[model samples]
Structures are given as structure tokens and as C-alpha cells.
Target: VERRSASFALRMVVHIVGDVHQPLHAADGVDANHPGGDIGGNARRFLPDCNATNLHALWDSGGGRYSLHWVSTKPEWEAMRAALLRDARQMVQNRTAVAAMDPLRFASALETATWEEAVEALSMSGGFGLVRQMIGESAGIAESEVFVGLQMNPHSFGGPLPCPDAAYFANAASVSTQRIIVGGYRLSFFLRHIAARLRRQGLLVQGGDNVFFGVTNAWEAAPNAALH
Candidate 1:
């Protein structure tokens, strides 16, 4: 079973922590297995102005693109990074062992708990806290790659969206396969957008590089997530 797979379990950790934080992820609007294929708001076109599919994708990504553009300049990056590192250090330093780790356990232990409950526990657990920490670490790498690439080859910002560039696409066979991976990509992209926005505001200057920003206002923007 998928739940039994180690990789699946790990992905579950990554997803669930973020998922439960999403209000819509916790709500009950669409069925997972349906003829309409409207799995968790990813499907279900709604109105003329809103694209549920697109909106849901944005929320899933955690506002990544927006954050990056806002925080693009040099001075912002330096300040944000310094603040983020200091905060990360202080947080980790004072954390208790129990508060800092949530070692992976066999799926059997999760049997009694609902998926939501397990996720909440993991979010509160030290290991999951470490997962949050790693977000900073990984974000640092992703941002550095983007920043250096931009400095060496600056692109003229001429688009509606304030992104460093346009977009990236991928393809896959089978609905399940497509949805499974696309979910991660969508979420990652939105987070980058959020980082870009924070950069613009200078709230996430240095920390922006380390912070994983993404859209998180799904419940407020339900109509938007239904298109396409």
C-alpha cells in the first residue's frame, strides 16, 4: 500500500504539515475519488472571473513567485538573510530535544490516528520542526541558484506577474501520476511567488532566501481555485 512505502511516508510528512495548515485542505468540499476528477479542489471550474484550478494551484504553492519579485533587490536580500539566520539560530539553540525532533516511525503507529491527527502531531513534533528547518536550508539553495543566475543574466521585467521569469512546464502520463507530482510543483512555484513578494516588501530580505513563501489564502479565494 502507498501508506506503507517509506518514500510515500516521507512525502506524507512534507505534504501533511503544509496541508493541515491549509484551511481548505482541512475542509470537506470535494470528494477525492470522483467521476468529475475534482480531487480536492484541483478540478471544478466555477465562474467567469475565477479559475479554481489555477487558484488552487497558487494556494498549494504557498505564494512563492510573488514573494521573490518583491524581495529581488540586493539590500533587501542582505538584511532578510541576516535576520533569518539569527532567528533560525536562536530558535534552534533554545529548542528542547523533544521540541526539535519527530523521528519517523512505522505506519502501524499511525493506524489509530486519523491522517489529520497524525499530521498535526508531526507538525508539532521535533522531527517535523526539523522539516521546517530544512525548508530554510533547501530554500537557500534554490534562491542562490536563482539570484546568481539573475545577477549574471538579468531579465527585463515586462510581464503582468512580477516574476524573475515566466514559467516552467512538465508532462507526464496518467491522471494519478500527473496530479501526484504536479501538486508539489504547483505548491513550490506558489511559494517562490510569495518569496518574491516578500522581497519586494523587504520583510523577507535575507530571510526571504531561507524562507519558503507560498499562497495560503484558499478559503478566502475559493472561486479562484476552481477554474481549469
Candidate 2:
């Protein structure tokens, strides 16, 4: 592959891994209340007052409005960005356990990720597994974190449901950040493992660069952005 293709591939892997960490990406949010299926909360609102107003958007954009969800306001957007990077950094440094997860799914995803199927199905299928145990893990988070506010009130699907409280955002942020941290760890591990195999076969150079998503330097870089 050309350098650009390789680099693009690497970037896509990093981006997709991050994308999957968003809880809603792994869940369809179907139940008796939502007979039509939540469609990853796209049809619903996050809260009666929250800008996103949809459960899926809430998790996808980090407590903000649509399109420019996190960018509704410059100051608030910057703050969210800073917090995201800071928390992700901390989790990356502390998420050593994630690397030990057996049979990372990136291999399979990567295999199919680049391929263009000749015959496209009417509807794509997805609802657990096939994501390096990520679907299973995220399902647990969706159950606990996303449905948390629901326990406080009586509503379902689209509605004037109560807004999630400060406590809820805190929990969501933590979960999202930690998942990204594990993502970086898994991505790093996958690349290194691949490179090592190539080196062993005398196909490439040794001691290749470790792809740093700025998490490793969080301590020295964003000391003020500590977990809250």
C-alpha cells in the first residue's frame, strides 16, 4: 500500500475504534416502549431541555446540541474538548488491563472494514459481539449509564422526559473517556503485534514508532484537566 493509503487506513482504524466506544453505536435501544426501535436514539431526545434532546445524541456528542453538538458555544466546546482529551489521557495511561483482553476484534473488523461487498444487503446487521468484546462491554454500559435517568421517571422513546442530572453527565463522561482510553491501548497493541510479526519474518524495520494519540503525555501536558 502507498504511504497515504497506509496512513489513511491507520487513521480510519483509530477513528472507528473511537466511534465504537460511544455506547449507542453498539445498541439499537429496542423494547416494549420503543416498538419502532430507537435507531441508536436518533429518533429520541436526550432530555426535555438538553440541546441534543436525544439519548443517542447525548452520548454521541458529550452534552450538547446537534451537528455542532459540542460546538454550540466556543467556550463550552473548548472546555468539553479539553476535558475529553484530559480524561482520555488518564484512562489510556491506566487502562493496561484492556490490552490483556483476549482475541481483539480489530483483526476481523479490519479485514472487512476495507472491503467493498459486491452485493449489499437491504439492511445491515449489528447488535453485539464482532467488536473485540466491545459490543458486550458497551451493552453493559448502555444498560447502566444510558438507562439510569429512566429509572427516575416514567417515560419511553421520544418524550418530554426529565433531563439527566449533573451526576449522570459525570458518569457518562467517565465511561466514554475510559472506553477511548482502552481504544488507544488496543490500537497500539494491534499495531505493535502486527509490526512484531513482520520484523520476526525479516520483512520490516525494528522499533517502529508507537502511535500516540496524546494520551501518554497527559500527565505533563494537561495537569489541570484532572478527572472530576
Which structure among the candidates has the greatest TM-score? 2
Give me the overall lDDT of model 2. Answer: 0.52
Per-residue lDDT value at 55 in model 2: 71
Q: Alpha carbon lDDT of residue 205, candidate 2?
A: 35
Residue 150, candidate 2: Cα error in Å is: 1.6
Cα distance off (Å), candidate 1, residue 160: 21
What stretches of model 1 exceed 4 Å from their correct place? 1-8, 30-38, 44-53, 63-228
Q: Count the backbone clashes (under 3 Å) in each candidate.
A: 55, 5
Which residues of candidate 2, in runs, are more than 4 Å off? 62-85, 94-132, 151-160, 194-228
lDDT (tens digit, per residue) of candidate 2 on 75-121? 98788777665655555454335445424444334423322220111
Candidate 2 scores a C-alpha RMSD against the true structure in Å of 8.8
What TM-score would each prediction reach against the true structure? 0.23, 0.58
Clashes (candidate 1): 55
For candidate 2, the 10 contiguous residues with the lowest summed lDDT are 114-123
User: Relative to the true structure, how large is the alpha-carbon lDDT of every model?
Assistant: 0.32, 0.52
lDDT of 1 by residue, 54-143 (tens): 323433433221122337789997776565444334323422331223233212233255544544543556565433533443334223
